[model samples]
Target: MRIIAIGDIHMAADAVTRIPEIGSADLVIINGDLTNFGGTDDAKRVLDTVMTANPSVLAQFGNLDKPEVNDYLEDLGINLHKQARLLRHRLCLIGIGGSNKTPFATPSEFSETELAAFIEHAYEQARASIDLTEPVEKIKIPTIFVSHTPPFGTAVDRLASGTHVGSSAVLSFIEERQPALCICGHIHEAAGTDHIGRTPICNPGMLSKGGWVEITVNDTTVQATLHDRI
Candidate 1:
């Protein structure tokens, strides 16, 4: 499967026009930040543009997006926050939107414990009827996790001050679960790749700057490429 992962749009509609390079993707995953403190209408406009660009869109609301945007996306059946869906190739996609609390006090903020609980709940929701006795490594189908905040101390969450302002809970989850892939974006300055144990993590950066991540998954492999428009 070919998936285009993008986030941190910050209301730059022009970025949508430059995504033809995402060509023929089976799915388009919008990590978060569809708007910059905008309302539901703005979220709709962004989502509409994305839907027109790619019919298969799974999105979540970011810290910059108003809480109502979540409902709007849900009403449209494009919301992925705390949700999961099956994709082609026996792949499962699970999403957790929002972020850990920041000094800025964004619209969506969660404590470490809250974030961990949210993840656990979401995982349960994702695996509903499936037997989970088998180790995650033994599962035939691969699962991909999408989050707004990068895991702690990763290359993708470093601040300008050189601080790693990522989520400890996210890091712990990655270390423990080791999902096939974890795609995240919240720190634009840290648009890059990192790893926790055997799992690969990616932060595609802000769409407003024409940055995105392209992922290709096959029976035995999953690869990600970071793209930045000049």
Candidate 2:
């Protein structure tokens, strides 16, 4: 599967078409902040614009998006907020929307515990939906966690001030479960990749700024590449 991950859109709907492989990618995952506290109408506009380029899309609403936008995404049947889905036959996908409690108190901020629960529940959902009856090695399906916030203490979470403002709960989860990939965003300046144990973490920054992550998943490998602008 070829996947494209983008975040912090902030209403730059036209930018989706700017991606080099937007139309051809197997899947497009919008990490969050599709609008600036915008409602369903605004969400619809942005999502529709992306659909123009690629119809296959899964998304989560970030802190900057209005709380009700979650329901709007759910209605669209492309919501990945605190949810999981099977990716072809190669991977399991899970995600959590919103950021861990921020000082600005954004509309979709979540407590650390709540964020932890969200990912855990989503993982369980994914596991329950799949039949894991193969051999031990065959049962290990590669996983992707599309989170809105980068995990704590990673290169993708550092800001200009040098503080790691990501979620410790998320960090702990990654350390424990070690998903094959974690595509995160919200900290715009930290548009890069990092690692937790063997799990690769990526922050694609803001889509409006032309940041994204390209992922190619096959039976042998799941490769995520950082794109500063594409």
Candidate 3:
């Protein structure tokens, strides 16, 4: 399947207007940070704009997102996932919103311990619900994880201080489960793709400044491409 993913929109109406022409992909995934300031009104505008642009849009909340903002997106039919779910044509997607705790204490801040627990819980729940013995054709599909924070030490997460601010818990989870893909964005500068074991981890960067990432996946292979709008 062809998937176009982007993040960090930060409430840019121009970028939203340009999105439909980006490509006619089978699916569109918005990583996070849908607003400049996470207010209900701002979130409403962002959600309305995006839904109008793409009917197949899948999104999650960012660090700046408030509960009202999340509720608004959910009301507009965006999948705000703290867990995984299947989408168009059996594409499995999991979304975790927010980032590791920062000094500023943003809306989406989660301590490393809390984040790890959350991921672990989600994985266990998914594992319990699936029947592995069933044929792949008959059984539940595998998932591609989507989050706002990248896993630690990948090329997609190198900060300006030369530090890796990604989540070790996320890295561990991917190493264990090996999802089809991991798409994320929080650090604007660290926009690219790398692998955790067999799964590809991608950070599509920010959309407000006109950046995005595209990925193609089928039954067997996956590839990613990054682009910057002029």
TM-score for each of the candidates: 0.94, 0.95, 0.85
Number of clashing pairs per prediction, in order: 0, 0, 1
* Error of model 1, residue 166, in angstroms: 0.7
Model 1 ranges with Cα > 4 A deviation: 21-23, 129-132, 135-137
lDDT on C-alpha atoms for all candidate structures:
0.84, 0.87, 0.73
lDDT of 1 by residue, 50-168 (tens): 87777788899888888898898899888888887767537777788889989998887889898898788777766763456664445777888899999999899999889999999
* lDDT of prediction 3: 0.73
Lowest-scoring 10 consecutive residues by lDDT in candidate 3?
A: 131-140
Model 2, TM vs. native = 0.95
What C-alpha lDDT, on a 0 to 100 scale, does residue 207 get in candidate 1?
86
Q: Rank the candidates by lDDT, best first.
A: 2, 1, 3
Better of 2 and 3 by lDDT: 2
Worst 10 residues of 1 by lDDT: 129-138
Candidate 2: misplaced stretches above 4 Å?
133-138
Off by over 4 Å in 3: 19-23, 124-142
Q: Which TM-score value belongs to model 1?
A: 0.94
